[model samples]
Target: MRRLADASAPERRKWYARGAFFHAEDLHYLKFLIGEGARVLELGCGTGELLAALRPRYGVGVDFSAGMIGEAHKAHPHLTFLVGDIEDEAFIRQLPGPFDVILVVDTLGAVDDCQGMFENLHALCARETRLIVGYFSHLWYPALKAAETLGLKMPQPAQNILSPADVGSLVALADFEAVKSERRLLLPARVFGLGRLFNRFIAPLPLVSSLCLRHYTVCRSLRHRSADVRSASIVVPARNERGNIEPAVQRIPRFVEDLEIVFVEGHSQDGTWAEIERVRAVYPHYDIKAVKQPGKGKSDAVFAGFEVARGDVLIILDADLTVPPEQMPKFWEAIRSGKGEFVNGSRLVYPLEVQAMRFLNLIANKIFSILFTWLLSQRFTDTLCGSKALRRSDYARLKAARGYFGEFDPFGDFELIFGASKLGLKAVEIPIRYASRTYGQTQISRFRHGVMLLRMVVFAFLRIKAM
Candidate 1:
């Protein structure tokens, strides 16, 4: 295997240039999976082309073959290249790293001990690091062999043909959790722009997606965490819930000693802002803060509150008090214990209170839940639940990357949901009993919001799946 790799080192650029279109597609998906300016480490990085294309702030490429490392250094002098066996425990442990993203593209199948390689990779990962593995689908083995025989691709030594399921199992065996997995690239070569159309539209469809050529799985180390207790910030986006202001604070369980509650009133006419101020004054013992949102929707209000929040963990609490404040502790514990990086409240699990949700709304929530489960590759029982928790640092990362989706969400639910999915945060849902509002009418319009949701579904498809 080493001899074959060494012999092909001289022609590496030639082969990649011949298949420029195919390679470009792979790079497109990789760029989407990895953010720019991250600390990156790539194993079996042949010629370092992919690593250089990623534009990492600090980039390192390692390969077992000296010829490949030499070529990589000559081609991309900005990146560090080293010739070392990835399966060697001593060699892998000596590297300096806690990289933000690690790439193992098509390298696992060539290694003798895949599980050992994955275990060694844990040394290079922090809690937020993501391990991305991209490989060719075993179903395309015959086509790849034919291309190699025809001199259209680089020749390779005999290697294992692993499926997505196989890779997922190996990840689990190495104590890593598989967060997301998918297949793409229906057409490897671009033929008069039809390849782009088919790959973008028809290739990602349900049954059709399974037949694609490329497979990618993203995993994160499960054992990486800190045991320190984190502070908490709960932002309540209030509209007209004047009567529920004081009770919202009082009902909250003492989840943590260092906690701050922020109330963002959104141009309510029912004296909600005055009620928030009164509650702040009355609760001298509790740390309460009130602020009027500069904008109209719940999304704006929540973000406004987040801007001023000073806590290790940030949570959203609906001012309507439908999802009881008592449930806040569950979210806090879920995040603090490292059970999940993002904790979402699920109202669909337990029985609903009288008039908690209307018939149509319940049906819509179920349908959206299914759609989001498919779209995000993470199961979501309730997508629009206003109660959620995530570390403030994760929120800052998500907020920085928010420009990709733009300001599309008005209810504030999809903003966090989409952001969490993009950041590869481990999502865990906590079951909570749903209750009807006691003070004010619901701020939702069934038909109008339903139409808007349909639009969001289409928008998400274009932004997430089609891309």
Candidate 2:
């Protein structure tokens, strides 16, 4: 308690943000913390430098140091700055919250007890909130000790080093699951230009270079506290399948407490939107909406619908009815139970309905799934099933990771699948009954879609499997 109280005293934190390179790395870490427009509360924010760097929609920085709080306020007037102890629940609760991210940087070493500190921070966040924790790595102790002796590193003793395993175990006890971890550097200022180039191209590669100096972990709360959880938004893209919209909605057994059906009318020349709007009137009691496609294809329609979805969980439901809507619970339950971060409905495993898939399509699916699974070491039975569920938060993260893959996919499957792989998400497939589309026509030109799918498989193999 004394350590927590004194660690961030005004006098101690005044000198915290003097280094430019260190500040840049801290900003880089913040980019990983939250999506743009996310709410944030940074606990034990010394000089509130990190809070200032992140610039979230609602940024709040709390510190024990009155000096740090004052400095934080001056630098980021838009953010609410408070003087408080993170270890004190009453104090923590006083600060406004329900933040999307709870950030703690470099303060972990100062806390008297990591477990107690994490518990309090976890209580201040939303269920979908992510915890971004970063610390000086234990392996760097020798180098830091030497640097401190020569006045190169921060002047502090032994700095309460915790191993990666210890940190993981503590996070679990705090009821927050660790999703990812990695090392990054705060390059010295002497070679600023060269350092930028290294980080941009060279340093990110696994083979070349320095690690074990810094560690960052991305975490999610295991417990949820929302009083009234929002309904899952299910986005369905209908093309020529005008006949199937009614059954899809009718058979969509409401697994979630609240549900909204978003139908993206993919420029179907066969009056798919007309049928959708007709079905909409029938379900006026149910929350349903019809959105015209922003672009011509199913992928474009899905992306457009995802843009406006307002739900705790976002789901993609195929308009073809190939995967039954009743089985949606499987995907939802999988994510809720933490069985996997992504739950994809699989039709290849089951004896798909007679004439459901042409032999060529079946073979293509099997071949593509095998290549992707083998390449990523992530199992995938059916690649084209078109039913997947994840929270809106998860989807945002995937979109950010999409920078690694480029906008290479026209179908949007690779975008999600590859992001899940890169983020280290557990990708599991759920078998479902595949029913043939009862509609105007099949929009897929198998040869073209197959070629695209093959290209994606190869690309994923190089990016994820190689990594």
Candidate 3:
């Protein structure tokens, strides 16, 4: 296989060009998964196209074919490319450690020992690092073989035909957890633009997704946390919730050693700003900060609070106090213990308090949860929950890459949820006993928000599922 690849290296660019549409779609999904200026490493990098396209702060490509590495160096001199067999333990040991994202795109089939290759990657990952392994789905074997015979696709050496289950099993054997798995690109050719429609819409549908030509499995290291104690910043977005101000602060337990509370007032007419000031003064012993949002929506308020926040972890705690502050420890522990990267509150898990949620709202939450679960390729029990938690570093990365989704989210929940999904952060739900608001009327206009949510569903479909 090495000799074959080395012999074919010079013609690799022509082969990829012949399949331009498919190659471009593959790169598009990769760019969506990986943020620009990340530290990236790619194995089996043919001509280094995938690595260079990522525009990483530090990019490295490794391939067994010397010819491929030569072409890669000539094309992308900025990136580091090496000619070495990834299957060799000694060769793997010499490479750098701790890349932000590691990619094995379309090359896993040639691997002789998949489990050993994955095990070797352990040293190349940090606790937060994500490993993406993309390959042709086993179901596409017949179609790919026919394409190769018909000269429509690049000919290949004999390789392993692995299913998602096979990849998941290998990942577990290597002591890594598969966070999410997705099937994509049903039609590999542009047949009068019908391929785009099939790939963007029909391909993502429930049963039809099984027919996708490519599959991606996202994995994360299960290593222990580097530090035992981490600080937290809980951002409370208050809007006309004056009566719940002090209680919100008072109920919060100091779960972490260092905790800071930030209250962002969103132009509330009911003296919410005055109440925030009062709470800041009253909670002198507690680290508290208050700020007025420059814009109107909750998303704006959350971002404003994030700017002033100074903690290792950032959390969104609603000022309405529906999701009790006492349940915050679960979120902190989830991140601290490496259980999940993005912690979301799930009000639908445990029984809600009487009058806590309306029937229509409850039905909508369930429907959106299913939709998001499918859209993200990660299970989400509740999508509209106001409380969410993530590391400040992860939040920084998400904020930097927010342009892909834009500022389309008004309620602030979907923004974080979407960003977390795009960044490949493991989403975990902590069941919370949602309670009825005690002090303020509900600010959400059901019909207006419903229409907006429908629009967001379409937006997410385009940005997420359709790529």
Candidate 4:
């Protein structure tokens, strides 16, 4: 412990001397996971620069080095700094707890017992608390060692050299589940014009991203207890889905608790609005509401229905009925089990019904899935699937942060998925068989929409991946 403290004593000044590109990049990614005004506690916090930058409502930083803690106090008096070993259970218990976000940046390697550090973190976290850990990638071991030898980086004590999988196992052992993980910072030092472009754009690409400098893991407490059955709202966005309205109303299964069906009719040449009214009257026993969409696009229509929905859980179901309404129970069950915070339906997992999707559309879906998996740092098999479910509270946060991507998404799928990723929410895909539509023609224009989707991908790269 004395040797560890001595090694990190000069780090605060050394970090500023050596261009802090990795530090800046790490803070950028962490800020996305932890929104503004969160209660944050950072372990092994050296100088507390990252904690100060996050602007948490309440911030506490702990370091094994008394010198580091003293420098942190002098640098950022607004936040509390303490000298304590994170692996010590008694020391961890003394710190203020129930933090919304707990950060461990690059210091896990220096810890004596990595698993003990994770176990101690549990005392500071709540059910909703998120634990974010960032560490140097073993792939960059030679480069980092060379930098340290050349005095370009601060010298450190011998590291535990844990991989992302190792850290994940330790977190699971400590009663937390891994939500998401990714590699970042391909260029740790500025290289003039190419630095921003390479690190932000090129580094996040599928095959290329694996060679980055650091790995970050986001984890949440494992909920062994089941969630209670809550009221639900299913929002159906109709734009030429007149023929499926009555069938949709009849097919939707009853929920254990309250269930309301909301129909948002967009501008359609067919009498979709009339069909919605007809279904509402026919299914008077069921809770149903109809409204004319004030704006264009499926995103606008979905938002309109969601605005009027009154349920604890909110869901989006395309009126085409390609994903059967019967699958709602499976989605509800996943959320009710506390297995996932965001439930996405995957059509690509199971074999699709004949003529359910065009060959070109199928290929496009597969391609986009690969792109999004890299972009969002989460496994996404089908990004265009029209069925998705989430808690109303989560939707509100997503809606508030929608401006980050702007109103570019017409499909409404990307907005939800992107927002969930930004919030570090656990997204689980529910596999469902895709069936051929029995009613109206497909509203999607294959070539035109495909081009738009490609543009959205680039937009996401700039907004999400590059960030």
Q: Please give each candidate's TM-score.
A: 0.98, 0.72, 0.96, 0.92
| TM-score ranking, high to low | 1, 3, 4, 2
Q: After superposition, how far is residue 272 of candidate 2 from its true place, in Å?
A: 4.6
> After superposition on all CA atoms, how large is the RMSD of candidate 2?
5.7
The Cα local distance difference test for each model comes to 0.90, 0.73, 0.89, 0.85
Model 1 lDDT tens row, 285-400: 98888899998888999999999999888999999999999989889888898888888999999999989999999999999999999888889999989899899989999998
Q: Which stretches of candidate 4 lie over 4 Å from their true place?
A: 3-11, 224-229
Per-residue lDDT of candidate 3, residues 216-309 (tens digit)? 9999877533424479999999999999999988899999879999999999999999988887887799999999999988889999999999
Q: Per-residue lDDT of 1-467 in model 4, one digit per residue for the tens? A: 55666567656667655667767777787887888998999988888888999999999999878888888888899999998888899999888898989998878887877777787777777656888988888878888888889988876656777778888898888878899888788888788866667888778777787898878899987743245547999999999999999999889999755999999999888999888888888879999999999999888998898899988788888999999999998888888888988999999988889999999998999999999987887899999999999888778988888888877777888988988888888889999999999989988877887888888898988888887
Cα deviation of 188, candidate 3, in Å: 1.3
Q: Which of candidates 1 and 3 reaches a greater lDDT?
A: 1
Q: Which regions of candidate 1 fall more than 4 Å away from where they truly are?
A: 226-229
Candidate 3 residue runs with Cα over 4 Å from true position: 224-229
Error of 2 at 357 (Å): 7.8
- Model 2: lDDT equals 0.73
